[model samples]
Target chain A: MQDAPPSLLAVDGLTYAYGARLAVDHIAFDVRRGEVFGLLGPNGAGKTTAIACLSGLQRPAGGTLTFDGAPFDPVERPADRARLGLVPQSLAVYDDLTALENLVFFAEMLGVEDPREAAVAGLALAGLQERSRERVRTFSGGMKRRLNLAAGLVHRPELTLLDEPTVGVDPQSRHHIFEALETLKAKGHSMLYTSHSMDEVERLCDRVAIMDTGRLLDTGTPAELAERAGLPGADLEATFLELTGHRLRDEA
Target chain B: MKPRGLLSAAMCIARKDLREFSRDGVGLLLAFLLPLVLVAVFGFIMGRVGGGGAPMPRVDLALLDLDRTEQSAALVTALLASDTLDVVRPGPDSAPWDEADVRERISSGEDPYGMVIPQGYAEGADLILLRDPGRDLEEQLVLMSLVGALFDAGGEDFAWEMSKRGLEASGLPPELTGRIEAVVNGFRFAVEAMFDEAQANGSFDEDAAFGGGDGADDDGADGDGENAGNAGDAAGGNAVGMAEILQLTLPLELVDVAPEGRDAQLGYQVTHAVSGMTVMMLLFSLVGFGRSLLIERDKGTLVRLLSAPVPKSSILLGKLLATFFTGLLLVFVLFGFAHVVFDIDMVSRFDTLLVLTLVNCLACTAFAAAIAGWARTEKQADGVSVLLILTMSALGGSWMPSMMMPEAAQAVGRFTLTYWSLRGYQGTFWYGQHWTDPEMLQSMGVVLAIAVVLLALASRLFRTRYVRT
Candidate 1:
């Protein structure tokens, strides 16, 4: 980890607003290659907003974003999309199409030469090869999450963004998604994982960032963050609760 | 902009959309099957009303008999003899012919004709004829002539009986009565001769005016002489010629006849209606497609796709192209269905039809995209698109011909996409009408212009919404 190269995706002083409201307020973060970086926050704490900006869905009002040493401009951005992927909060895979077909479609959009082979490989990697021919609507929550991840990976993207990929999912599906993320990490794929589950952040993320009210409260390894909050023996969840407060965020 | 990359991306989106569309059986059935079912149901109903075999004009009449005499009965019988009139009696026992009922039926488009008979019609010296100015003139004439003939016959018999009684009361000599009869007969002969000469001269003048040259007059005179000579040779030929002329001239005198070479007029009307209806419905699919963009944005699929190497223009272009192709396919399917089921002529002026269809489809697709671009959610897009489409279809002459609409309403129709689409379609099937005809060309141009503007607006709006600043 110490010998790893610097962050491949970096956001500096990023700010975004929706009309009169600032969604993400001067946030800053970096995600290193081959590392699982988690953004942990309550709903509407700007986790999704920050990820949206990074994923080129929204432009920052004030800040700079770079992907792999290049400034990111969505309009001018070339088909570097082939190197990046996202597993949306909802099972973005079309419910009516077979898992294989969804993967193939995304793969083709990413300009993969052999979409079928890529789809098969992705399904195998996500441990969804058995259900490749089944429509997504028939799949369980866990299977859908796994297939969603497979669809993202069909293009063999270098970086994958997971936006609450386990929300409302069954325990088994949550476990499967974590395992799949681990596999992707093993293959040296960088990831930006956002979720509200402290335990998930502790278990899966190599580095964690806690945020509230569109501002990053802290960033470090789970244990390091705990120590910084002056709780020597406390877990990451306890540290997060103490720093961000236990009150639920009333997101609009 | 790698063309291959853009093509591949567009194909991907298209393939996905089509697959999803096909897999949602209920949705597909609603989009395609439901409209066709509605058309079939309405078509059958219209067929029944227009007559099961062919469409024919219908006239409604109300009869009143104050005299309760044989003459009145004969007049009513004659009125019933006409195939054009559907005579209805007016009374408590009969069907009510209230103004409310008449107006309601006419507004609801049940029938275009109505008539009223005054209470003292039989006793009056002149029959009070009430006519719907909106109805065909020929229909009215047929009804009037039947009643007139009955009254004339009765008046003649009454005059003859009066004269006989007067002579008997005076005890006049048979010779004096016979002389009076001869004078009346001579007057009748002169009047009849005069009427015949006037009719022949009227026909000759009409021929001369229309013929427009000395050459035509020579031909007409020669033909007339030959015809008269031939008439002398064959008794049946003369009778047939007279009968044919009466049959042709009688209808012409009553109705403003459509011009010759207009055999495809009905086909043109049907095509216009079908095309307008198709454009209106295709909006549904457009809304569905546009909503997918919102869904993607909310679910992060758009971000996922954008983060990949795909160019923004390629992504947008792909979506637009997919929509355009789908719209084109929909139009083709509708035309094909109409042709096969109704025997509507679709292949006439193939190039013009194709061009018109393509242009109209582009406009529809562009408008749909614009709607999608403005909407923040799928539901908003769906609702707005449906409302807009329904309003446009109604105002654009889908249910009735624009010519039948009030002048102000016809002007309003020009603002709707359906109007332009209908105009283009009508030009395609109707003969002697070129695409370059000012009205058709103007409509097509407007549609194309709208497509261009809408497409530009859609692209701009989409970029503004989705692209990173």
Candidate 2:
């Protein structure tokens, strides 16, 4: 059998908090090289907080984040920061700027060698080259979503932390985004994708980590997770429900 | 990162901000246009109401000509010409009203004071004044107006008699008083002799000799020193001869010694309006730029920026640079408007003006950053900025001259940046002082110091609000 791919990033006992309340509680996971690792969780499951810590937006209260076989603290090391990219859940583009302008600006900010060329390439990657000059305010939600994806990739970082990137996308735009991600995966890019869509997670992620209330419940491929939950024919969703229960998590 | 890289990032961000701001056409127009309109309106109103252009309120006085003589009619015309009185004549030219009519008006409170020319007034009969007892201020005003009219009517004789009476009231030793009286008589004789010679020559233009007519200077005594000196030169020997004659009549001599060449007309009201409105309005503009920080955070652009490889200081420095340049533009725009509309002398002092304005803008930019850093939301920033800015403007003499405020308030005004900034500006523009002057340097130094403290505070607060978790 082929040896498992070597790890590109590892999180050991990662923890974070907002004042007295813990937002990310001692969760650990790893993304191997050329792997699309999925972090599946419901609302308030600490997925976004973990992503924030990784992106250097929040300082970890206690934990170790190792990247490329070395100690990683993006907050202390801007070089490490430049290696990682964040696609925030919010539509973070300047509405007044055109698609190309937003890409170029973010690209330059990320220390890309040639921001203009990268921006053009990013626009094409998101299938938005035809509308690159149009202001984001004039774009549809799907188009904006696509552009937001392209913005995070403009710098071509090794690891991209996408926090619910397809939350409110139309199916057509969603399909295009899936196709783009597939292409990136083929190019040996690693992504830490957090999503609520079961089908997309199953189809895209190489290995999935089921999390709830800041704790990781399980980590395995879809079939292995079903077998471990003792429901051999059940899908990943059934395993998630079985492990995390049917209770609603609506508050953070 | 290198200093150049940091500055480059800041410039890039400022360019982006300015480009976005440019697209807001209505905001751009209102930013420059509203202050100009306000400056024009405030300048005009203050000029009129602050004793620059308009006369004080006139008191109404009723008149009844009982004597109906040439002298009484002349007194009536003089009273009508007095700026202090609104003369109300009782009857038409065909028939005049009696003293009873004048008394009735004063008693009924229809007019505060009334003048009645007694039956024998042309032959030195005294004029009777009818007045209401309660209106003391109005009564005094009317009496002063009457005295002025009487002086104009009597001319040289009235002045001579008044001076003699004043001398008698002084109760000086009889010998000294008599000797002084003789000197005055000689002066009167000398004046009559000069007049007689001028009349003989037919060269004495009555209006020109008395400094009357439209060609007379506004402040006939002393206006522009250069113009006055020129007039003294043109008058030459006649003016010298008149001065010697005038000196002989005086118990205490008066000297017309003023600075040789000083610009007394500094356009003070225009200066106050321009400086006050510029400082106040620029605060509002810079604070609005500060509010853009909250806006960017709300719009999530700040998050994207923070997540990038740019240093956090560069982000803040970029915002500061943007606000600084924008504020500088606003200051020049308002002053430029004043220059065009009010004909204020901005060109001569442009260098000092630019330095003072640059420092002022830096202070304002720091203030903007502080406000943005302190407030959590756009609405909160708006409310806080208005309250603080207006308070500063009022306390710092942006609404009026600090000298006009209560002594305690003026002392308090010294603590505000607006006060120092306006003092620097007023010194440069209104008082014609150079930037190297102690007071000007002090203002610049204090403003720079305030900018430093505020920038430090802002940097801390921004780190807490935007950078740290």
Candidate 3:
């Protein structure tokens, strides 16, 4: 077998908690360079918390996260931070501004040398070049979703953390967003995507990690997870059901 | 973080915020238009005409004529003809109201001011001008009108009485002094009638009342202040001349005095209202600006911004800078409005005003940050800010000067930033003192200190809410 690509992101003993409640447990994983890593969990399963910690939003209570071989504090290292981008679940965009303007503003904040050129390139990546000059308030849900994804990639970050980018998107818009993310993956952009949908993980993620109650349950390829669950002829969803059980999540 | 990067991030955030504000037309209206109207209305209603035009403010005086004598009539007509007093009288056929009823009308807010002419055949001379105790300017103005009327009504009688007292002290025979008094009374009555005529015709002269009136051809009673020898002719024993009578009648000359370099010019009437309004509107604007934090929180913009590589402190700094600049804009707009609408002299003390303006802006931004950090929701922040602004304005002498308020209230006012801001402006505008003057500097220092402490507390609270918590 060919030697595997070097690990671009390594999480060792990562743990985080709110006061009196643990949101993330000591869990470790390695994401190879240019691979899409899916973190699958149910509601209140610490998937979002892991993403938050990994994106440097929340300080991990007990963890060592090393990106590109050495650990760095995002607060103290703006250059390192500029290399990471987060696309949040919420539509984090200024409604009053045009798509191009919002992209330029965020791009400039990330220390991009030529923000205008990056904004235009970002719009093209999201397939929203024709509507770049329109205000976001006047855009449809899917269009805004596309713009939201574009905003995270404005600076062309090396590692992108996507927290439920398709949470509220329509079927057609979801397909468009997935295609755009796939295009980035083709260009050697490593992404840590958190989701509850097994179909999305199986179709898009190169490797998968299942976590619940702040602890990691398993980590393998979709076929490997299926085989490990003893469901030989099953797809990723059936294998996931067998491993996690059919109980209601927190939202249920 | 590099300074240039921090600055670039701040500018980006500020530019985004400004774009958001410009899109909100209604909020813009409240920020700029509302203050202009408020300042104009309050200034026009409460101020006098002495802002580079008329001599005095208008007083609303109601006349309750118990003494229907010509003396009272002359006083009433004179006051009505002049622009100083707006004389109000009952209908011609209306029944005479009691003194208690007149007092009730004024005390119960039915009338602004009332004057009672007691029926004592002009002997009592007790002219009571009824006024509300809440207003100092009104009381002082009525007293001044009374003095002016007194000069016209009983000038000669006062002079004759003074001459008679002098004759008695000089040891003149009782009979001879009595004869002098009789002759003085005849001439005094004639002078009073002449005054009445002069006032009715609207040609009332100040010099005429001091024994040098229109008919001042009585030997030594001319305008040059010479003795006419009228008292000597009447009193064969000891003469009390018209000049002596005038000297006794008007012992003290009321003269207007100003400082050596600074002229004591009459300040614009709306000055108090403008200064107080500036502070009040700034509070409103600052609170509104601070609420943007709550808005971004609700909208998830803050969280996303924090997630970026930019330092969190830079975000706060950008917002503070934006708020300070907006406040400066408001001050320029308000002062411009005051200068154009009410003829307020803003340029005379531009340096002092600018310092006070900056202090107010800093204080406002500090308080805004504090409130945003402590408040959980936009609604909570807005409600609390409104209550605090109104309370500060009331206690800090926005409606009236703190000197006119009760001692307890004045003491309470000293704790507020509003109080210090008002005092700083008043020192420069009303008292003609420079910003470096002792009292002015002290007030500005207090405001600056308050701003610094508030900023420190706000920073702590902000960190707790955004970072630690």
Candidate 4:
């Protein structure tokens, strides 16, 4: 009915491999302006590989990525790359640096106007303002996760790529992070969120793409995907199970 | 990217690295204090062994006097009175230091040096020098001391006898030998007459005899030219100078041609210790800093850096800058400590030292970055870097004098940065060469070339392994 929000990032025929084995097999998705897009998969389902390709840490074998109505290749079009912010799955903040120092360094890297001011603002946004001066090495996993998110957000790019941002965090810190993401959404920022948690994806993502074994299985809204799975009114977990199956992914 | 922007990013990264390095107290101690302590220990040991104001210690020589003649006794007393040798002789009751006993002593390594004055030593028999091999420098000193003792004890007689024996032993045709012996005898006669005149007169007319009566142009000319002047004076019916006559007959003076104020042996060992340790530890500390890249990759922070909006080269350039600055500081600190503790004259050659040190640090920084970039893991980096650095240090004469190595090993040492670095410092401190000296420039050029090659390799490795993925 209503026109889908104009796509800010569009991918087509994206492919990658680790040697002979395919890790991202011609999969495609889009994150429209001002909305959260989710990529859902099991442990070895290539979600992180897709994120790595999008964030320029990797070069895909075959793909045409479009950002803001222009062809985007991070290596060739670094200005387009500047519009992206990537939060890797690992806790990537420097342990020896204070929270404020880490944020400021990232801000400087991203060419923020005033690194200290942006760092302070990022600290407040992550709910880590009180401990900004303390080294990240002393922080709990949850606190570090929060600061990690804040570090990624210092430059406030148009699209934030968050790969399993809630991993290893306490439920309270997860709630705090979700609240921060919600605030960014309220501010009209876009995000591409990847995770294994169906509930979090159902709650935060306006659209979802389910992948398995490096190939996209489906993409739809939660209710639409549930209905398509023959479970109307069911939660996203039921639809996820139906699409990706119940096999133990770690063993695979 | 703009140059300013690139420089800004690089500085930002370098600052971050320096900050992190500063926070690791143990690392700081290892990087800074360890070299100082090692240098101090090495400096003290080298000073005691072969340095200090004295160039070498007094050598102990076993003396076997088979002649037991007045000339042999005079030789023994002169050697004993000399500063360079401690003459060890048999006691009155002991068997008189036989050649067999001394040879056995040398062969068994109980003593490494011995000398035998044969029964005909006073009658033109060759004196025997026996020693275990592998002590060439000490052997030279012993030879010099023996010659000086001979000159002191036997004077012109010993000189004439030794000359005649040398001429006869040369295996030359008898005709040539006879002519040489005749000329030598004439020169000896002239020298004896000059000595007698000098002994009779209270003061010898040195200028009239040696300078051909001009007295204005002596000015310490060469022996040949001074001999010509003495000839001219003699043809003019003037007396031949004693020194010129002796110079023609026996040119056996031992002169140290080291730089005016510096002690050659002491300065050489000091420079060897300082530059060797400094260059070796630079690779250690700089590569240790470069290993931060591997640490960041393991911690996943490298991915974040790649994801940031900066030219990828800026990161590596930042590491290079940080490493270079750190290495420079470490070098200056070590040298400063050496200056304070060992009294090396660094201030006199500060400019030249700084230039060489800057180039040396750059080469080391490039080497560090290349190792860090090429290694796939920290463990691999550690193992490879240690192996290469230690090998380079040893081959480059860091552990011992390159001259002590076999000729081929010394040739191989020329390829190592440590050798060139030590050579440059030796040029500066020992030979008193300035930075613009050709040898110093060659050292800088070779080191700079090594840096360029390593930097290019590092760039390729970083691109493949970290940047492009």
Candidate 2: tens digits of C-alpha lDDT, residues A1-252 = 999998889999999988888878898889998999999988898898899899888889999999999999887666777888788888888888889988988887788878899999999988999999988889999999998899988888889989888989999999999999999999999999999998999999999998888889889888889999999879878988998889998883
Poorest 10 consecutive residues by lDDT, candidate 1 chain A:
A74-83
lDDT of each: 0.68, 0.81, 0.76, 0.83
Error of 1 at B89 (Å): 5.4
Residue A179, candidate 3: Cα error in Å is 1.7
Measured against the true chain A, the candidates' chain A TM-scores are 0.94, 0.98, 0.96, 0.97
How are the candidates ranked when ordered by DockQ, highest leading? 1, 3, 4, 2
TM-score against native, each model: 0.78, 0.80, 0.81, 0.78
Any idea what lDDT model 4 has? Answer: 0.83
Off by over 4 Å in 3: A245-247, B1-4, B49-72, B75-109, B112-269, B348-352, B431-440
Please identify model 4 stretches exceeding 4 Å from their true place. B1-4, B52-249, B260-266
Q: Which candidate is the best by DockQ?
A: 1
- Candidate 3 chain B: 10-residue stretch with minimal lDDT: B232-241
Residues A92-176 of candidate 4: C-alpha lDDT, one tens digit per residue: 9998899999998999888888889999999998899899899999999999999989988888898999999999899999999
lDDT score, candidate 4, position B169: 85
Off by over 4 Å in 2: B1-4, B47-266
Query: Individual DockQ of the candidates?
Result: 0.54, 0.35, 0.43, 0.40
- lDDT of residue A217 for candidate 1: 89
True contacts kept of each: 0.55, 0.43, 0.48, 0.60
| Maximum-TM-score candidate | 3
**Model 3 per-residue lDDT tens digits across residues A88-119:** 88888888889999898888777778889999
